[model samples]
Target: MEPASETPTALLLIDIQKGFEHPTHWGTSRSTPSLETNVASLLSAARSYNESASQPILIIHVHHHSTSPSSLLHPSARLPGTETSAIEAADFAAPTGTEPVLTKNVNSSFIGTDLEARLRGFGAGQLVVAGLTTDHCVSTTVRMAANLHVLGDAPDGEGIFMVKDATATYSKGGFDAETVHAVHLASLDGEFAQVVSTDDILGRVFR
Candidate 1:
């Protein structure tokens, strides 16, 4: 998070919410056990970069708030009497100070939210993405970030850097958690994002 880097590559953390903690709903286990630690590392570097530079680094948090009251993500479902939503960002990834938080109901963070507009407003052309459920929100956001022209119409996700170790997903169908995670990353690699790792991004961020 040092050096007079170029226009800062914004970090987008999506759907890192409490409801995903339900193993039954997601899976018995998740793909990456180090997901929290990896994302926290990226977050720390982003904060340092923001604080050290005049041009602030944008570290945005996007949470999913399910539309249905029965859904685990909805406040009525998880909090019950308290009515507090499970949409609260995980402790390590929560927004602090001036960082922005966007609540979304769909897989893509850009849909039904001001995410794209915010990125545009901040002039954030490059983005480093990480989050829960690698195949869902994280993958969708990365694809839309390219297809929707949010990151300047790069067909091959030129501006989107998807951090592999920082993202995770659960098993579905007949597949296992690790298999699900690997397949999604492979699918999103060349077509939707430049699949990267925490150390790889940190090196570039600190460059």
Candidate 2:
């Protein structure tokens, strides 16, 4: 989907999966309550602004699921009927039909998914990303969004906006949540996209 407006914006909810509940990925390092609470807040904010026809709030949810044998989160790794494979219950409770969920395997939401098409269809130019593990899928997707012009040969412009408070990261590659979150946000803000909080963004949507 293309940006609906001259400066159209949308929100991308990335990888708020139930698999993170396991002590291995999120529980041990990132913690569930921290990630879940922030995401819930962002969802509520996005939903409220979207209600008004004047304010175009497009919400696209991105879920991560892997089928690769080498994948760290293969289905076999998870217990049957766990929230890991399905969309979290909280997400379903979002204002009905407002959020459409997209499942992906690669870190970048644009990879092997119709995300670009959906964004273009919705006419969304700027994207706000919020969800689990800021250093991995969220970080990768932001980088891709910022650099998409490379493929299309368009002039440089603000491509993505990340909600800092709404994002969470795990301890990975020798970096803990504090270090990873800070470094990634610094690189993303200005360079890749604007970084804002759920409250600040909520104000814009409502006002």
Candidate 3:
């Protein structure tokens, strides 16, 4: 994956939380059965690449926290396996000290967080985005990332590469999850970002 420039790149993981994994609470019908596995593999490769590369990759996690007490994702609500809005253990490995987790309440990770500033601070002009609900948080954040102008005059000129297989969405309103996932990817492809697979990311971008 050739970057737009030599600027540092970051792997932005969005809303890969346990709250979305609770079958009974969140319902079934996912875009891919191997979504978590693919995400974990990508995360591992990104971390490894950061360690060995001359320009380290910044790994940032965007976590969602609902404020309403009745919401399933409310921080106080407990899932079957975890007590908080923690990253899903089944699909994601534990994060290290170097990685920072940014919390947000809305769909876009950039809305209430310093993510844009942080990316600029790290000198990251390219973003590798992956996460849950391909049609929701993933799509919103990517669009914002592509349009973000940290320097004030023009858009930050960031290049966003989305991992297709590493993201999943739930079936909704009689539509299948797979179709929803594909439609969203199609909409984003060649527009907000380039949609690619985990294998493509590992082989081309991570190296």
- Report the number of the highest-TM-score candidate: 1
Candidate 3, 146-200: lDDT as tens digits: 7775323334333678888888888887788899999999998886788888888
Query: Candidate 2 overall Cα lDDT vs. reference?
Result: 0.66
The residue-by-residue lDDT of candidate 2 on 124-206, one tens digit each, is 65677787668889888888877774223333336566778878776777777677788888887887777877666665532
Tens-digit lDDT string for candidate 1 (27-111)? 7778999998998898888788767687766888988888887778875556434545667777788788688888888899999
Candidate achieving the largest lDDT:
1
**lDDT: worst 10-residue window of model 1:** 1-10
Write the number of the candidate with greater TM-score, choosing between 2 and 3. Answer: 3
Could you estimate the TM-score for every candidate?
0.91, 0.78, 0.88
Q: What's the best-to-worst order under TM-score?
A: 1, 3, 2
Stretches of candidate 3 off by over 4 Å are: 3-7, 81-91, 149-158
